[model samples]
Target: MKNKEKIGFMCAYTPLALIDAAGYAPYRILPSEACEDRAGHLLHDNLCPNIKKILDRALAGDVPDLAGVVFVNSCDAMRRLADAWQHVRKDDRIIWIDLPSSIDAMAHAYVQGQVEQMGRTLLSWSGSPMDPMAVEKSITSFNRICAHLSELAPAFASGAIPGGYAAMQALYNKASTRDFTTTLEEIEPMPGKTPAPKHDAVPVYLFGNVLPDPKAFDMFESCGAMIADADFCTGSRLFSPVTGGQKDVYSRLTSHLMTKPQCARSFDPALPGEIAKTTLSRARAVNAAGVIGHVIKFCDPYLERLPGIREHFKKNNMPLLILEGDCTLRSMGQQRTRIEAFIEMLM
Candidate 1:
């Protein structure tokens, strides 16, 4: 990927396969550091912490040089961030897509259109039209990476391999920033590092907007909580498996984006308790003893629906623990005692 220009993308719904086919490497901008007030002049201080950190990072020159940026209008915070990005980085192409919360046919078609437009822009950037087979090959390579994670999910939760959750988190972080083919090297355990004795840690399912720091997982493990499975921007939902059988590649790819383990932004009004239902399904799949719902501060979509989600979890007899923070390890570390008590009760 040395010859390929890198394009920065934020949301999971962005069509990374298309970016790969366009002869570019996809760079996912994850705000892993503490929120800074430096971006306050660029955007509001009350905005989502993830947004603030991402903008602040760009200003600090901590980000890679990219030919373009992809942003999803999944919520007001994200939309405003895209608008402010122009002020921060004046010379890069910024592509914004309107993500629909509905999962109907109309929504699918709308996503396909957005993806195709994104494809066109990417192809133009490369100065050549991408071959259909290249797109398929790119998707196949991405699915290979996802398959690796699917196999490791059990160890990640069971604590069968000590530090498995941290290892998995590192892989996901690398998968987003580097080439998929290059990421395969670090998938397996290193040659000399031996697996530590497995302990019976309290397995818990974590669902949130973004938990990018591997140290965050380390902190949980220290508190006797093994992240058996999670639904986060930097975790399971990152590179979703794109299902086959659709002749049109865009349709197949867009379907995966729209229907993968979703964030709180999108919903089907006709389906009552959708978020609760999905959360239960995911948590039960891993046989978690309890559920942990972590949301970044000021994230309106998740915050507004949290009350309903909590009530649903309670009704179903699931032990739920809610944590709110600024998307940093410092914030998570402060809640250590609370996390320990919750894990102890489950144990």
Candidate 2:
């Protein structure tokens, strides 16, 4: 088996365990500032900037060599991204997974079947057979990675790890390509350095769409605030641990997916207030003084969820700042005044 092959995925819904099981490195296609105008010409300007930046990279052939790319139907924009990729990169093998929007018994079965199918597809792509042991081993490795990240969370929140922005960058970088052990070795604090003394910087929880640039966090910190925690798909959401210890690989994957952080794309009619509750719980966990929601322009799901979020924060007397951007450092820089003002308000 050629272990050098790589498989790319865009959403958190993609099962990294299955990708690893198929003897391919899992690569996350994060947002970048490259080719936004070109992508805007292909995709509508009204689309979310996160999807647009990803398509921009794909169009520019900026991605790493991959055996295939997997796209999950987490939202309409992502589905359209897959469609656009098909037209642009016809030679690349593209797989689309229809993720269930809700969480329930039927939804669980549907997602489990999708994951199993993805595993079969990966095996075919890799010219390998289904290996249950490989799948379980991958699960254990990923869980270890999560455990390592969990250990760093307290240090990160308390300003001991240099800065939260750098920590978040290290996290996304490690998860995208490196294995658990390599990631641990790379991020472990150097010897003989005392933890940075905690400050009275306004503790803030960052929420919303993909913040690809760590500079965004720097901007938050520069404005006299500290990022205590993040509720981003590419950040803390991706590091959620797998539980249940299910023997079946697909069952284990599904169980983990069902309990992970709730994105705007994941809807449960039975729990309308789930996202707000999750956000609140995370904020309170770090004793956050405020919440900042930095979403890309034209992200409908998040825009729709904003009213409820506002109401929740208002009821609790927690300050909430919603800033829309185009998913670039330039755009984020433009919001500095607003962010600084928000932080001043919190202070």
TM for every model, in the order presented, reads 0.94, 0.93
List, residue by residue over 178-261, the lDDT tens digit for candidate 1. 776676566644332234346688879999898888888888888998787889987778878888689888889888878787
TM-score of 1: 0.94
* Runs of candidate 1 exceeding 4 Å displacement: 34-36, 188-198
Q: Give the Cα error of residue 146 in candidate 1, in Å.
A: 0.6
Q: How well is each residue in 301-322 modelled by candidate 2, as lDDT tens digits?
A: 8888888988988888888889
Q: How much is 92 displaced in model 1, in angstroms?
A: 0.9
Where does the lowest 10-residue lDDT sum fall in candidate 1? 188-197
Clashing pairs in 1: 157-228
Local error of candidate 1 at residue 55 (angstroms): 0.3
Model 2 lDDT, full chain set: 0.79
